[model samples]
Target: MTNNNNISLLTAILFFSILIPLFLSSPPSSSTVSTKTLVLPLKIQKPPIGFLSTSKASNSSNNKLSFRHNVTLTVSLTVGSPPQSVTMVLDTGSELSWLHCKKSPTLNSIYTPLSSSSYTSIPCSSPVCRTRTRDLPIPASCDSRKLCHVSVSYADASSLVGNLAYETFRIGSLTRPGTIFGCMDSGFSSNSDEDAKTTGLIGMNRGSLSFVTQMGFSKFSYCISGQDSSGVLLFGDEKFSWLGPLNYTPFVKISRPLPYFDRVAYSVQLEGIKVAGKLLPIPRSSFVPDHTGAGQTMVDSGTQFTFLLGPVYSALKTEFVRQTRGLATVFEDANFVFQGAMDLCYRVPPNRKGFSDFPAVSLVFTGAEMSVSGDRLLYRVQGMTGKGGDWVYCFTFGNSDLLGIEAFVIGHHHQQNVWMEFDLAKSRVGFAEVRCDLVSQRLGALGLNT
Candidate 1:
């Protein structure tokens, strides 16, 4: 009896040790397991995830979500003796238009500054100028100083700083009176060299002091093409069928600056998936914001991928790994194990699903839910070594190891013609779709391979 009691005690200790942690970490579920417990790990460390305290602002009056697709625009820079054509990222999150300066002595190689004479400046005393400066955070020098000073700080610690100047800028066939742009004099050396390609960014998103907003077009809409084409940003009430039914979410005031050109928050509903006409449980989160350090949905067109936070990232990765247990081979690249390519000839285990048969991963935005159409879910990056050994894969979700922020990022190239509308009065956001083919042609003409 004594021996049996001792044995029983030891067994109980071991059982509880393993079981307690599993129960603590498991995600919320209706069913309970007798002996098994789920263990989910938290990702971010410093600032805890979730809502922070903030002051309440009046919700904007326009609360509907909608979009315009494939609207084209002509962007030019008047720096040299003759003007030059340049592509621009129309972003509402941002407040200024900037160009990559090739000849400005003070300009960084990553950013090209337009000539001083290329734009007209609003004096400090002007009423509109004061309002623009006050609302947009433009410097005091912009008041009386003909040249407007502007700066953009990115989540990756990269920044573009320059003087704000107004120049003749056109989008599609509609030419605005004059547009204010930032003549970039400095490059964000912290970012990769690829960030330097564009002439400048066009801030068209909500709350930004761009030409469109300053000119009083509060209800502007635009489109961006997909990876195959140059995207379009339009300002006006034009509508499109591709925008689908409008869903609007109130814009939550951000405690910190957002990853996009401006601070805008969105609420998305991910109706579970439909497999073979049957619905499967789909994950949903309300506060997922754009990943910082990555480019904005409106600007930084060079990035080819998007990122998500740790919880979502881990969930997706675990599911994919479990589904492709047999076909998945771990390849070491840059300190991470990537799922490598495999042939489908080998038979998969009865319990394990093959990679080839994995269901498509869909991302639902306000306007549409896009599915991954390719065989491979990860986009493999060429290894730094010439031997093609240490390749890196694009992360679909998680904090960017490079950016160090807890957010989701949508690359501009992948989400062209997707319109983001911000209504300050209504405190709501909207989305729409656009055509990407013509945008692609324009990008090709400018040596940009989408």
Candidate 2:
């Protein structure tokens, strides 16, 4: 979905879903026998270009989102004693799950402070509040009255601010006690439609207080099919016999002490990229961790478009242009020149039809491999440069200039139509190609015996 002449500035903020293990304290040993795996169906959506969004159809009051929002997925589950189902974004890039605090008495399914007997506040001086770990290094501080205060900011200045507290969270048949979360009383809305849609964010990173950590698990995995179908996100004990011939690669740990690395993300080694079976000229070192200790490749559920450091993007674009010699050069605006964080969009002429011959793009991971077909490599659009314009497909991959510094990001666009598993026990990342919508025979569910 490309933007019209007046491109929308709505950008998908980095939700940094990192699942690092605990080093500050001895993490509770994951109970293998009794650790019940929970299965939650995720509703995924591809909201326009250069943005992110998704919510239940019933959440229409204030959840007006732009036509061009980013690719975001939401999971609906209840919380508190009576179990009020609330929809929150399933972000691997975030640390703690949170909810928008209710101000009015009649707000739909929001968290009411006066209600819920399981609610417990984390004091500013409490041990949980003072712990400085990755993703949550700035551990929540206390306000003047000694209330545990938490504030989170997203990529486009959108934010969530409130008190830190714990409540009973019930998703599917699984229930968790003392689930850590922020009572979001205030925050920024990218647009009007997003005001009420800002129900909350569910964090599943590696922080001690993250959903996975609180649940006492070392591993989890999600198979994303795409926008049309609901996918499975399983926590604990995922045996991928359904995805035949699983290729596993070491899930390297980049130390957090370095200021350059976010430390909250799961990092992987990228050897290089190939287009049409030909390797790009980009040096392998460019994809690896640089001297500053940054630029390692990562896979994230929150990011919509795959981003490459400047060096990789330049080389890839050059090779791509060289391969597709006859394709239309997608021009934007009156200048018809490419600049900014995103460019390289071309439209087919009136007489001509769909993309004729596009080359395939592949990522060469350390040990694993992902073959990206040409269709997934570009964004097909009907109108963009002008009204009722010819259909075009924008270059879905982007470079460092648009993202500020050269940053390596493997967004969900590349993750589609594949089976991916993040195994924390062996510290490895595994992948296989398969149909995501097919119902898989379960190895485990929350209450059912495997």
Candidate 3:
């Protein structure tokens, strides 16, 4: 839907509904298996233009879409009997799909169980409640009604208290009955502005109860376009020549339980970092997770900026400052930090229209590399300017230490314009840089025929 100013976002949920039935209805021999693509068009809203105000900036880093708020990758899902379409965030960092069940004055939509003919809450005696949720950060418990219930809290301080239930889910032509999900009865969000507009979240993490795992999909891919446009989310192993040959990296295999890291996270081995074509002096061992499992690098679509450990961040910031000494004047004011985390601020000259003089930054993984240059290297923190009315641009990377999270994170800002394929069967992640707008256009034109 477009705003009154003519800025458009995704208006519909496009799907190739034939996929689920083809894979689930019958057992296919190796020779008979179909590798057809299942598509879901993704919607993302752009941050407003310069000099905008947001009340939810400090709630969490995920809310900070590179200093812009309310940016999320969303898709529509039809849930309950006599299904109703609900907008959901497609999150790779969370495990359970949930819908807001309680009606609130501020909420746009809620799934009322009394209205659904097929809604059935799981009893506390059910093993599905106990076994399936054992590994989750927030495990299931029995409510006063002897129903399976859970209370989940996000880093943003938003929470959902819900009961586990089984209900029918409709995805285009494919209707799956008795699907398990969370029917939340109560919740509170620090960012009620965006929460009021959407229903809930769809978890796509590596955990057992995630949407991809529940659907039995061996692989999935998504292309996040520039903020103004729509993108495509795909499931199954259909390869496109236009995607080109992707660089592959193996996900870290944890043999035992981790002390600090989320065991089910999509983590990869990070080799090193390079600034201005020169590799940093940090040691490779520093990137490896210690006995406490603290340093593994994870790819999280929910977060907005990349975060590194304190030592690694110091090395990077030092090298970056060294290379861009004369390009722009550093904002040396003690209070220049943004959100109390991003401290590398610079005052660009009034005539400086671009950041071409700044050095490029690269994150080198085992068999892949993510390079950031031009506008990607620095984000303009609008609504706030430096002395002499010069615009301020801060480095996009942040310190993971600020969050007390010991692991490194690669967030959404770096994933733009790239096709990321998470192959669960092979336990590998494939990435290739491409114009996501082209993929969105091609998929939009093909529609559900594919």
TM-score of every prediction relative to native: 0.54, 0.81, 0.85
Q: Which ranges of candidate 1 are over 4 A from the true structure? A: 1-84, 90-92, 101-118, 122-147, 187-196, 211-304, 337-358, 364-370, 373-376, 383-392, 400-402, 413-450
Task: For residue 293, give model 2's deviation from the true position in Å.
Answer: 2.4
Q: Quick one: best TM-score, which candidate?
A: 3
Residue 357 error, candidate 2, Å? 4.0
The superposed Cα distance between candidate 1 and the true structure at residue 321, in angstroms, equals 2.0
**Better model by lDDT: candidate 1 vs candidate 3:** 3
- Per-residue alpha-carbon lDDT of model 2 for 1-450, expressed as tens digits? 100001111123333322221222222222232367667776675434523223311123342222223446667778876776688777765566788876633234477756777777666666556664333534466788697777665444455578777777777666676677778787664443433553676776555566776767688777777545566677677554566887877765764455445454556788889999998888767877766556766666666677677778888888887887776654444323222344566665656543436888888988877877745777654223333555445677776455354346677667776777777668777778776677332433222333
Q: Total backbone clashes of model 1?
A: 48
CA lDDT, candidate 1, residue 80: 24
Q: What is the lDDT of every predicted structure here?
A: 0.35, 0.60, 0.68
- Consecutive 10-residue window with the lowest summed lDDT within model 3: 14-23
| lDDT per residue (tens digit) for residues 1-450 in model 1 | 000110110000000000000001111121221121111110111112211112211112321111101122323323321344565533333345566654443333323233433345444344434444433322434523464455554432345555544555433333333455555566453323223333555544343444455445545433444343333333344344445654554444446553332342222333333322333344543223344412222211222344444444445555655555554343323323211111011222224332345455655544445454332244332221112232223333323322333334343333444555545456555654444454334333332212
